[model samples]
Target: MTLGRSAGGVRLQDVADLAGVSMKTVSNVVHDYEHVSEAMRDKVQAAIDALGYRPNLTARRLATGKTGMIALAIPEIDQFYFAELGRHIGEEAARYGYRILVEQTLNDVEAERAVIRDRDEGLVDGVIFQPARIDTLEIARLRPGTPLVLLGEAARPVNTDHVMIDNTRAARDGVEMLLGRGRRRIAFLATVHGDITESTHLRLLGYQEALLAAGVGLDAHLVLQSEGFGFEDGVRAISSAIAAGVEFDAVLCRDDLFAMAALRGLEIAGRRVPEDVAVLGWDDTAVARYSTPALSSVSPDKQALASAAFALLEDRMQGYDGSGRHEIVAHSIIERATT
Candidate 1:
C-alpha cells in the first residue's frame, strides 16, 4: 500500500519496496517497534539510510498529533548549573531536529505540578523534568501520559527515565581529598539541613561517611545548613559559622555559587583560601576556573548527560514504553588551588 507521498516526496511504500518489506513493516521500523525482528529492522533502516528518506515532520505531526518540541522543566534558570544544563539539553535536542522550551519551577510545588500537566494533548512531545518541591509519593500519583525523562535526584522510581551523577560517591571523593590534604574540621555548607531532598541527603551521607572513614568525629555544629542553594545563602552560612565561633579548616559547598560566596565571605573574615580554609564545590561550572584561587570542584560529564537525556527522550518518543531506566554519567574531581 502506497501511504501517499506529499509533493513528489518519498512515501512509506518507497522505503518498503527498497527494503523488500510491506508498508506496515516499514512503518513499524520507522516507529521503532521493539517487537520487530532485528534483521527486519536492520533491513528497513539500511533502506532508509540509503534513500536518505526524510520524513515530513509537519505531515507526520498532523497524522500523529505530535508537536516536535519538548519542555525542559528545571528548578530555576537563574542558577548557573541549571542554566548550563538547559543549554546542553537544547544543543542535544537540536541534533534530532527538535526544539526545547525551558520552564522554571523555582522549587515551587505548584509550578512543578503545572509542568507535569502542561502536555496540552501533544502540544509538547515530552518533558525533561527536574522537580524540587514535589515528593516521590506525589510524583507517582500525578503520572502524566506524556513521555517524561526525569533529571536529577528528585525523581522517584516511577515509569520514567532519569539521568544524574553519582552524588554520594562524588561527595565522598571531595571530602576525602580534603582529608588527604591533612585538613580536619571540614564543614559542609549549603545543605538542606534536616528533611532534605535525596540529592542533599545523599551528599550529606557521603560527607559523614568520609569523616567516619578517616576516623574523624561527626560534629553537628560544623554542618552549616542553608535554606536555599544561592550565593547569598553561601555568604550567610559562612558569616554565621564565623560568628558562632565554629572552627573549621575546610569547607565543602553544595554548588559553585556557594563556593564562590564562601571565598568572598572567608576573605571578609580575614582568612585566605587553601591557607586558612580550603574549599571545594560541586558542579564545576564555568566560573570555577576563573575564581580568584581557581576553585576545585566535581565536574559531571555535561556532554554525556545531554546525550543520554536526549537518547532516552527519543526512545520514549518512538514508543519505547519499558520500565524506568536510570542512566548515570561519569563525574571527576577537578583539583585546583582551592584544594
Candidate 2:
C-alpha cells in the first residue's frame, strides 16, 4: 500500500524505495536484527530520517502482535538507585530498537501485580524487574512470553534471565576495608524494609561475613537501620543511634547517600571522619566522591546492570532461546578520604 509522502506522511514502502532495499530488509533494520550490511542499515536509517516515515507503533502492534516497548518494573525511584537504573535501561532499550514503559511498585505486592497486568495487556514487549517480593506464589501468574529479567535476589519463574550483584561480598569487603584502615568498631547500615525485600537481607549477609572474618563479633547493638536511603535519612539514622549511646568506630552503609548521612550525623555527634570513626558505604554514587570527606564505597555499577537487563530482555523478545540466563557484574571498593 502507498500509505501516504513527506511534509504530510510517508509509508514503509517509501522508506524501502528510497533506501533501494526490500521491505523485509527495512523491517530487519527497524527491529535491529543482525546480518544487515552496514551500508543497508545506513541507507535505511537515512531514508527513515529523510522521508519522516514514522512507523505507527500502534498499527504495527495490531499487524505483528508485538509491542516495540519494554516494561521496567522498579520499586519507587525516589532514591538514586532506581533513578540511575531507569536512565541506563532506557538508553539500552533505545539501542535495541525498543522504548521503555516504567512502572513503580512502591514495594507493594499489589502494585507489582498491576505492573504484570499492564504488560499482559500489551503495554510492553518484555519486563526488566527489580522485584521486592521474591516469593514463588506472586510470580506464578506472570504471563508466558513476557520475557522477564530479574534483578537482585529471589529471582523466580526459573525460566528467565537475571542479573544480580554479589551483595554479600559487597558488604563483607566494605567492612574489612574499614578494619584494614584501623577502624575496629564497624557497623553495617541499611534502610530497613519488610523482611521480604532481598536488598536488606543480602547486604546484611555480606556485612556479617566481613565482621566474622575480622574477628569482630556481630553486634546487634551497633547495627543501624534507617527507614529510607536519602542523605538526610542516613544522617537521622546515625544521629539517633549515637544519641541513644551506641558506640561504633566506623559506619558501613548500604548506599552512598546513607554513608554521607552517617558522616554528617557523626560530625554532628562530635566524631571526626576517618580520624575518630571512618565511614564506608555501598554504591559509589557521584555524591559519594563529592561528600565533604569523599566517602569510601562499593562500586556496584548499577548503570551497567540496568544496561545489561534491557539488552538480554530484548534478545528474548527477538526469539532468542538463550535459556534462563544469570549474570553478575564484578564490584570493587572505591577508597576515598572517609576510610
Candidate 3:
C-alpha cells in the first residue's frame, strides 16, 4: 500500500499508520528506546524504510535535549593505535545510532581542556576522552555535570567512567615472553625524560617485575629514555645506547612504531632480530603483521574497550548519576618471528 506523506514530508504518524502502531512506538523505534520489543522495532523500521522517513535531528534535539552525538577526543589520530581505537569507537557508536565527533588534542593540555569545554557547551551529548597530558583533577574540574568516559593510562577521576586494558600486566606478559625465549639482557624502551606518565610508570614497573622474576638484575643503563614516542625517537635511543656500549640481547617497546624503528636500527647495527636480539611491541597494529620478521606484540582488545566505553557513557547519558565505574578489557601477546 502507498503511504501518503504530510506537507512537511514523511512524519512519525505516517510510519505509525503504515506499521499499524501508535506514534509513540514509531518514536521509540526512531529514538532507539531500549524497552521496545524487537518485533515492534522491526515493524516500525520497515514502515520507516518504505516511507523513506528521515529524522529531523534539530527537532529531535530540541525536543529531547540530546544531540545524538558524542565526542571522541584522543592525543593523536596519526598514531596507529589511536587511529585503530577510533575506528572501533566509531563502529560501536553507529550501533547505538550515535555519531562520533573526533577531536585530536595532540597531547596538548590546552587542547584537551578545550575538547571538554566544547562538550559542556552542548555541541555533543557526551565525550570519550583519552587524555595524555591532563590530569584527573583538571578533568573533574572542567567536566562538572557533563557525561564523560576516560580512556588510556591517565588517572581516572572517582566520579568518571573509565575503560582500558591492564597496562602493567600486559607489559609484564610481553617481557616474560622475551625472558622465556632466553633473552636475559632485555632492554626496556620508551622511557620519557620529563615527568613520568602513569602508563609509562606502570609499564616500567611490569618490565622490572619480569626481570626480577627471571633472576635477572635490573640494569639502569638498559632502561632507555627517549624524547618522544616516535620512529626517530626509537632510532635515536637505540643509536645512543649502542654508542654508550649498553649491552642488551632483546628489546621491549612501548608501541609498534618503536618496535618497527628498532628493527631498522638493529639492521643498521648488523643485529639479527630474534636471533641476536628479540623484540616485542605493544598494540598489535596492522603494521606489526607486515613488518619484516613480523613483530611480536601486546594486543589490547580495542573493540572491547570501545564497547565498554560506550556502555558506560550510555549509562551516564541516561541519567545514571553515581560514582565512576572502571572497566578492564582483555589483552594478549601475539607472538611472531620477532620473539
Return the top candidate by lDDT: 3
Candidate 2, poorest ten consecutive residues by summed lDDT: 1-10
TM-score of model 1 (CA atoms): 0.81
TM-score of 3: 0.91
Query: Each model's TM-score?
Result: 0.81, 0.88, 0.91
Q: Which ten residues in a row have the lowest lDDT in candidate 1?
A: 1-10
In terms of TM-score, the best-performing candidate is 3
Tens-digit lDDT string for candidate 3 (1-339): 112333348877878889999988888888788999999889889998898887777777776998889999998898899999999999999998899999998778899888777665787898999988888898888765679899988868888899989999998898888888888999988797774368888889999998898899999999998988779988999878988899899999888998998898898889998889999988999999998889999999999999999999999998999999999999999999998
- List clash counts for every candidate, in order: 0, 0, 0
Whose TM-score is higher: candidate 1's or candidate 2's? Answer: 2
- Distance (Å) between predicted and true CA of 306, model 3? 1.1
Q: What does candidate 1's lDDT look like per residue over 72-116, in tens digits?
A: 999889888888888999999888868888888877889998888
Q: Please report how far candidate 2 places residue 231 from its true position, in Å.
A: 4.4
